[model samples]
Target: MRSYPVDSPHAAGRILALTMIVDGNLVGSELAALSRSKILDHIDLDHADFQHLLKDLCEDLLTSTSHGAIQVDNALIDSVLEEIVHPDLRRSLLHAMWSIADADGWLADAEAVLLTRASNAWAAETNFSSPSYRRP
Candidate 1:
């Protein structure tokens, strides 16, 4: 898939969309946690619009699957992370991803893999200087 522009209006939604799609499927708890975070508000999407965005993201996954390639590239993740100019937003994005992964009360192997990729990608993009600073 082609990458979106860093300043695209959908950039923030894309981040959340990727978080939801990274594990290849969305669970009820993850969706609930995402909703609770009011992420859609930040993206200027209401619930109905968010549902449509989710559908679009799922379609991209389906298309990738049909091509026999269903993986999310680390480079793509880093590109997404690069769009977040603010350190706090980057940290928040990482935290939200972890929350999604743990929402089911158990982090699946697939979820863990995606979360690690995202974390490493974000760190690489940000060039984090402090080893002691943890996600807030």
Candidate 2:
């Protein structure tokens, strides 16, 4: 078995592709923030590399995040989200989460909270729904 570098830039396209799946209500600033936030947290995430990883990641996530009610129900949706965030992809997800939260390089309290909830949820063994922050 060959172990891959966790911070390898090869996955950049994949990240963007996955993120592109989720349509609507994603403020462009937010999405751009998300991408940037993820890279910032991972010291090795070069801005140039992200451009590449995004394509495949978005490709992986396209159908799953397709337009819909911001689904908080349905086992299938959860499963799909979980599948989309598979362990390998989870790194990218975490990276993306940080990217969103840290995009501006100033961590707002709310964004910090959001990052904790998401990264923690994604890191769980059984993949429990990420703890939520009440809607503002």
Q: Which candidate leads in lDDT?
A: 1
Q: Compose the digit string of candidate 1's lDDT tens values, residues 19-110.
A: 77777767888889888887667556677766766777667766766368686666666666566655556666677777777787877766
- Which number leads on TM-score? 1
Cα displacement (angstroms), candidate 1, residue 106, comes to: 1.8
lDDT of each: 0.69, 0.46
What C-alpha RMSD separates each model from the true structure?
A: 4.1, 9.6
Count of backbone clashes, every candidate in sequence? 0, 31
Query: How close is every model to the real structure, measured as TM-score?
Result: 0.72, 0.35
Query: Poorest 10 consecutive residues of model 2 by lDDT?
Result: 71-80
Give the lDDT of residue 135 in candidate 1: 78
lDDT of 2 by residue, 54-98 (tens): 544444444455475342223432333443344655665666655
